[model samples]
Target: MRCQPERGHLVYIWTKNNQFCALCDEPSGVERDLCGPCEDELPWLHDQCSICALPLLVDGMACGECLQRPPAFTRVETPWRYDFPLDALVTRFKHQGKWPLGRLLADGLARHLLHAYGEGLPRPDCLLPVPLAKRRLRQRGFNQATLLARWLGAQLQLPVDEQLLRRTLETPPQQDLDAATRQRNLRKAFALSHQVELRGRHVALVDDVLTTGATTQSLARLLRKAGAARVDVYCLARTAKPGD
Candidate 1:
């Protein structure tokens, strides 16, 4: 049975089930690990760029950056804006080894994708999780993108090609970098596996978050170079333009 919180209460008590919200510790009122109130508080992205999915001032419009110079990916889809609690959740999932939180985020992303496809968004032939550098992989013990993609693939029944992409360079964290610097840092960072056959395929690159989009652009260019007909980006959230 489905349930929702009434109003303004942090501690929701549901006697029927023992599930608690991942974020609030309240009784879960939804199918997922999130309580209704906490889920509703997530920063959902509404008006966004058609190409990049960056939060925009108006709906159904591309941002000025995308209009000036289009990204390599054809389209981007994200369920949430990278802000507040969503950001905190992502940080915990990515850095703190919180697999359950990652699962919840991936579930939300999968639902969004399913709804988008139902609304006529073109589905891709395969999903590719952005590769992590060897050093980062060793340090983190897992690639968060791969974990998200695996969950999403199972939910969507799409093939996941985790081996198709490789990160050759170990770049510094992108958080402090400007757009131009991020792009340069990612140059030649991704290379396609020689064994993979991507010709004429539409592929979606999956990631935990999209900041300046430099990473996705680099990967999409590599995919296109490897003969992927179309490259799209799927991320959990899209950050608003830097300093916005």
Candidate 2:
């Protein structure tokens, strides 16, 4: 699928400069160069599920899954749902080799991070992207999570440390797995880099989408072990109605 038609407006809002659409370089809507519908429809992460960051409820406690077993990240935020045109946006970036979408995704994520974490969240000194395996990176020609981290870091004015985390294990895709299987696959998949000292410093982990959150959980657990005082996740989109 192509990138969503409204994606240009979202980018305009985040960049806040009069930038021609990257895909077409055509002039966008007037003023901020955004049409009314696109601007209105830009979904911000609002009163939502506390655990999965979905959009069904607010003022409620954690979801059942988090109660049974919570994720390792201190908190999470996502501006859009992993459905509809947003899903298409992800595919365009990852599989279709449309790298510009990373900047668009990062813009949404930065706003949500500030909204959800607010003052309660620690200001991270560095951004640690959930690393990808060598083979996967070679096939994709890029790590989408790392791309998001870089762009998010620029927007948030945080440092993006590409070497803060390392991948010790590589497993098959988690898309076909259940929650338990997903967790098992990612276990020990992430290893903190001794080359950098993360201890006592807050770190933000970034990724494209959080499915079961197993990968993020595993990475966060490791970051905490490696002297990171606090860990948070910044993802572009999260699944809606997580139970499915």
Candidate 3:
């Protein structure tokens, strides 16, 4: 059950699962794992671009960059802005090997996606987690995107193809690169697996966070070339554009 907060207190409480808030370690007084205060403090996104999901001055308007040159993906759905506790949670989940934190974040994202689907967002035929390069996968011992995709697929009852997309090159992290360089670095970084047919299929690309969207765009282009009819991106958070 959902708890609507009023003046920092839970207005409606249901269930007593005794789950503790991942952030503050306080008892979660609601049905969900997060306590009412933490839930209320999530960095929710609003007034964003329809195509890129970038925070905008006004809602339902495409960002200037998107209007001039739209990316391969047709739409993006992200529930939170990349900031504060959300950023800390993602960093811990991705780099520190915190599986519980990752699972919690995935659960929240799945709920948001279900709500969006209820509000008429088109569901994709299959889900593809943004793949990790062989070197990184070996170094990390697991792919965070793959884990998130698995959880979300289970929650949504959607098919997930982990082998459909493969990263061909070990490019540097896009976080440190500028937009132009990021795009150039990822130009030939992805490939479609052999014997995979995407013809007339809609695919959702899943990832942990979307910063500049270079990686997603690269994979989306490859999917389109392999005959995907539509590409949509799903992520936990979206980082605001620099200086926006």
Candidate 4:
């Protein structure tokens, strides 16, 4: 059985100069800002769909939607569920421009990927961060995915190519739409750079969160058509279905 973070875990607070927990302001005593106890209480993703990584009753099985129509990507790898403190942290990083909070989350993701690699997950040839629409980028002042990809690249010793994909159309937020509408909204929404050669290359798309996964599906379709041998998604969090 999959385990979930026990809510209401006590948070410890302390003052230190070296490192402090992002959640409790306690001394981390490690390179990362998150301490052990707080890390243990994180909303880790457990039983999930093998393809899209959606929360599921059983592990290593495809969800109904994925079985009916498979996504362009092979698999999704995310460490957390978009719940509790994670959602708030992501908001601070993505909306409020808290780079440190984003960095902490990215660091945790890097460690997760490394463990996955150790467990035989194939390392991708390159990393491509999902691009943001020009208007959204202007409004946000930065792309969280780009920062995540860069940080992951540095930690994993992989190459990050931010120029490979471009968001051509500014679509409404996927959160506001249902699954079907989300797919339609992403149609012709992304364009790939023709200059780069991707034939037979294994690439992973980096992003902050995977909600409906419509965005990654659209991007993966484009990459597969462009001759990428394999496509995977690397995101910090995966959201569950409503009331799941």
Assess every candidate by TM-score: 0.91, 0.80, 0.91, 0.91
Candidate 2, residues 1-244: lDDT per residue as tens digits? 8675575466444565554543344665543333445534555556666766756666446776777877677777677777765676688888888876666667667776776557465677888888889999999899998888888888788888888688888799887687789888887788767656766887878888887778888888887777778787778887755464
lDDT of 2 at 136: 91
The CA lDDT at 72 in model 2 is: 70
Model 4 steric clash pairs: none
Those runs of model 4 whose alpha carbons end farther than 4 Å from true positions after fitting are 1-16
**Number of the predicted model whose lDDT against the real structure is largest:** 4
Question: Against the unseen true structure, what C-alpha lDDT does each candidate score?
Answer: 0.91, 0.74, 0.91, 0.92
Model 3: worst 10 consecutive residues (lDDT sum): 8-17
User: Per-residue alpha-carbon lDDT of model 4 for 112-227, expressed as tens digits?
Assistant: 99999999999999999999999999999999999999999999999999988999899987777887899999999999865678899999999999989889999999999999
- lDDT over C-alpha atoms for residue 210 of model 3: 93
Q: Name the runs in model 3 displaced over 4 angstroms.
A: 1-17
lDDT of 1 by residue, 61-147 (tens): 988999999888999999999999999999999999999999999999999999999999999999999999898899999999999
Candidate 2 lDDT score at position 4? 58
* Model 4, TM vs. native: 0.91
The weakest ten consecutive residues by lDDT in model 2 span 30-39
